[model samples]
Target: MSQKELTIGSMTVFVSQPYKVPQVTELIGRNEELELITAAWLAGPGQLPLAPLLLGEPGVGKNRVVHEVARRTGKDLFIYQGHEDVTAEDLACAVRFSDKSDRKMDYVVSPLVTAMIKGGICFIDEIAKIRPRALALLVSVLDERRYIDSTLLGERIVAHEGFRFVAATNTADLEGNAMPEFLRSRMRPVIPVGYPPREEIDSIVRSLYPRLNEHTGKLLDLFWLEWERNGQSTPPTPRDAIYVFNLALSLADFESLGGLRAMSADGEPFRVDQPGSASSLKESHLKRAMRELLPVSRENRP
Candidate 1:
């Protein structure tokens, strides 16, 4: 964990490290959502950037959309995971044992505060899970005031010129626990992220696992067949499709290693035989993986 000490008014604090970008594959789709978020962050003379709220299903790639935008815009990204127990102060700063020998305690800034201080993009995932009271703290930061007051540090931290904020919540969450109207009004242009088209989902799988290109079409067919057989109305999310393929690949590898076995009668330990070459993904592998990972309905089963 990288750390940097900075002076905030009279007190000095340690800032949290920016989120490390993962080895992301090509972003498949959501061109419109990407543009909306980018446009919302654009600030003109005498205008503040709009804070956009992303609404989507759990596995439909809401977070990925923000990550792609942040990467394309070349900005530091800070992620804050929102949950039921997150407090108002947790959004700003917290105290920790000092890493340095000179001090007894270290004031640690949260991702939200760090983003404001460093002019980065802050993405709060599942923002609806946060209690309305705790979320009230964001009112000032999301509005023209563009600052957060930390009661712990006794400092009013103003956002840098480039600071941007975006948050996402599952569609179910919004229906169950309504967001405060005050905060909702501040978060403009609510973007809905839906399941991608079949072609895009196929592209995503192929891009992420290039080695499966040969079997991609057949595997995808089986995936959709299973979906339809189960009488599913909507298409599977990209995550669901990807997991099936991932599991299929794992099954193929396991087969090549001489699938799991029991110990011999003499009590010899089980052993896995190393494969001389990579195994080709087969229909059986996909079917077995899907059955285990995404079981078919009992009535629909053959």
Candidate 2:
């Protein structure tokens, strides 16, 4: 698939893969706004509100859930990743030296502004990472139903009727790292997505990866079971399951190199927990491997 790009002011953001939103009817049985938000996007232009804040810790599929929702909703998504240095002008537009002009002057619209103009779904990620000043610029857009044209630019930029807003943030210890109550208030509904349940995750993995034979699936299940038992209260999510499966595939080749012959009664690599080998599945080793691939469950939960 072609890598997509969205213009944010003078900068450009490269989009990753196209998301596959879960079915709204299904939505993995979670009451989270994930299904509704994505469903609104699917309904197309001018159907939903401008503000819906998605909050959660990192790597819990917050972005993916939104992307899937957007995909399912059939809305063109304009993604902008928030950073510490981002400012209000960055969300709107900035003055640039136009090569065509001798005075070196022109105002270029940013991704947020362009999304507003084009009526696309504007996805602002990691919003809490940005400073308060940068976030303050959204006050008008979020509340007044209009945007203030920067005094420097000297032109009012009104959002298109189709513009929709979705912002995501991870919880933080620092005050600046949390979305201010003022901004949070503008969003009528704040959605918090928790990690997927084991059964739901297993279902997602199975749907996407049916080729994984029964032995491999069961091995992964055992790994998850062990991790849940020893790790903190939170368990490894489905995303973690995917990582373990990938790691095992790599290990299959490594076993061949180590001269540990791959032996399977049915012509497939033997499951890691098969009979005598179960003792080798240690908690410490599993935790370390999980930490490397997936975010630690305790830190990421909302």
Candidate 3:
């Protein structure tokens, strides 16, 4: 995506496009978490909006929660993906050659900066992946300071009053990564995004794979039985449910098409989309897909 350029205090910078918000049609059974995040965005005497940190396991819907809350508040969403190699300048501003201009340098503002300038919600996904040095840039922005000093731009950018911040980190990184204490202290509420209940999981699977029809409920129940009822220590997350359902349905189609498979690197499998020739998901397909795609299923067990 091409970024639009603007002059911020004499120096021209390319404005970062806020990452497109994924449209979430429904956020099942997460009313309380949303309320807390909304409350964090509130203000009172001697209070600034708390920068909430969403703590969760991978694929447990932390990103979805923040995106839905920001959407409900009618705020534009800016997403910054943090990584191990991210530096302080990368978080604030960086320079790149413009495609339009002949060898002209373009100052590209980061998503964090874009949100501050635009008064949108900035969500730093997998923030724990960022090194301590890079995260130091966030201290002022996340606290009462409400500003970031860009060494490269030689200017201090204050966050707009409407700007809100949220960060999500997987459990392993939050507890074990090299993120600094000061940065961690500023992001508050410590919201924990856990696995959804079985009913919600069933709903998500059904919604995501509606084509499965009668096979949906039975497949989800089998998943629950394999992970929950069988007393496995780690039950399948919502992601696993979606993945298994889609894979199983695909496998069922493959069976209908007489084991027709994708030969391309693009990963597009052969499809049988026609009438009575249409393949339906079955018990065997569900069982086989679970074993093949999910790590928790009986066949995948050591």
Give per-model CA RMSD.
2.9, 8.5, 3.7
Instruction: Give model 2's TM-score versus the native structure.
Output: 0.69
* Candidate 2 C-alpha lDDT tens digits along 204-256: 65665444546546655667775665455665555666676555444444443
lDDT values for all models: 0.88, 0.62, 0.82
Q: Pick the candidate with the highest TM-score.
A: 1
lDDT (0-100) at residue 225 of candidate 1? 85
TM-score of each: 0.92, 0.69, 0.88
The candidate with the higher TM-score, 1 or 2, is: 1
Model 1: how far is 212 from its true place, Å?
Answer: 1.7
**Predictions ranked by lDDT, top down?**
1, 3, 2
Total residue pair clashes for candidate 1: 0
Residue 180, model 2: Cα distance from true site in angstroms: 2.0
Candidate 2 Cα lDDT to native: 0.62
**Clashes per candidate, residues 3 or more apart or on different chains:** 0, 8, 0
